[model samples]
Target: MLFADDPGFPGLPDDFIQRGPAGIEAAAAALEHGKPIADIQQFACLPPFRRAGKILCVGLNFAAHAKEAGMATPDYPTVFARFNSGLVGHGQPLIRPRSSDQFDYESELAFIIGRRARYVSEESALDHVAGYSILNDGSIRDVQLRTPQWTIGKNFDGTGGFGPDFITADELPPGCEGLRMQGRHNGDVVQDTSLSDMIFGVKKLVAILSAAMTLEPGDVVATGTPSGVGLSFKPPRFLKPGDIFEVEIEKIGVLRNPVVAEA
Candidate 1:
């Protein structure tokens, strides 16, 4: 089921299962509505969350990505938290923060929490998932490499470009393995890969994170990017004013954004 936070809290379209206000409430509501989910193409997309309490991001979740960066595969999941102030919508301008000279894009899949959860078992983690959305976890490669700490380079206002539409977790049909994630500049494809390469799947990520922190409704966890980041390329491809970047997650939707000079 899909819900929009537009001016009107519109009802779930005829094609969607109705989910209610609270994450689980909304899911239950969706099921009760007995409405077939409308084609997501029919209705406009909404931000994953109007506001989220926290946005946790994972790094190097893909082995190929780790190798591309000249780093060894992670000993364990590399986890970090992003500030909510960075969230932005699809097609929005991703301001190039003046504090850094290197900016890059990392295409990822993000999961929205349906309810409060702590120490949730992997078998039951899907129950707490509200749905899934796309994320362009933009980063400032310079700062990321400057210090051991990567937070400063990873989270910047307008850098978190996400959401054209979110589909309920249930709608993701079974046997739909290996999602293709790609990035484009103008019309050329720069990065492409299959989700099958992810070292840690969504279930395991939530299980590990839940053990360390309580994930509440609206919390988001970005699965992580594949190889082909600007910094990983020769001569390094970085975002500049007037440039446009588009991220596409197959079966979900596409998110397009233009680069702009930050004040």
Candidate 2:
């Protein structure tokens, strides 16, 4: 619910996800009766959480993706860190830094935590998930590979595309398996795969990550992308200015963004 709709609240607060399950349910109930915006489409859709907590991104969690990238199947999830500064809302422009022309795309399954969980068991991990969404997880090839550390290359402002909607966890199958995920560049399908193909599914990721650190409400765990990433092609099809990239997951609507050169 918008703060403008409720004067009891002063200004806007950025911690919607931190509201916990009960608060979230109350808000959802309130929004159900609120007057709908006649022109919501014209409004830029923000990422579901606005500012989600720790973005624990997993890498090489897809077997085919690891194979295509010439990496072996990881016995443990290759976790990485991502900041919200690099995220762009749906229909927003994803800046392609002029510093490099090797920008790439990754379409992955991302989920939000609904509970504060630590030392959670894999069998009980689903109870901690609030909802599921999509992550394009954009990458800067040369820079990403420059070092064993992917932080610098993975974080270019406006490269990542997030949101359009946040489908409640109950809406999807357990662990989001059986769903198809695809990535497109300017309407051309580049990557295609099934969610069941992930090396580390949602349950495992939640249990494993939370075991190391407390997984609080709103933390986003991106479950890695499949094969067919730009770098896997004979001649990489890196993104360029004027391009339109999309990440579409079955059951979850598509998230689209336009590409523009950094000024």
- Which number leads on lDDT? 2
Backbone clashes in model 2, listed as residue pairs: none
Instruction: State the C-alpha lDDT per candidate.
Output: 0.76, 0.85
lDDT of 2 by residue, 1-263 (tens): 34565733322123545676766676666666656777443556767655666998999988888998999999999988999999888888889999999999999888999889999999899999988888889999999999999988999998998887788888899999899999998999998898999889999999999889999888899999988888888788988999999899998878888899999
Per TM-score, the best of the predicted structures is 2
Alpha carbon lDDT at 150, candidate 2: 93
Model 1: per-residue lDDT, tens digit, 137-236?
9998888788888898887888768877676676773212377889886667888988778887777877889999998777788889998888887888
Where's the lowest-lDDT run of ten residues in candidate 2? 7-16
Q: What is the TM-score of each candidate against the true structure?
A: 0.83, 0.93
* TM-score of candidate 1 relative to the true fold: 0.83
Query: Against the true structure, what is every candidate's RMSD?
Result: 4.7, 2.2
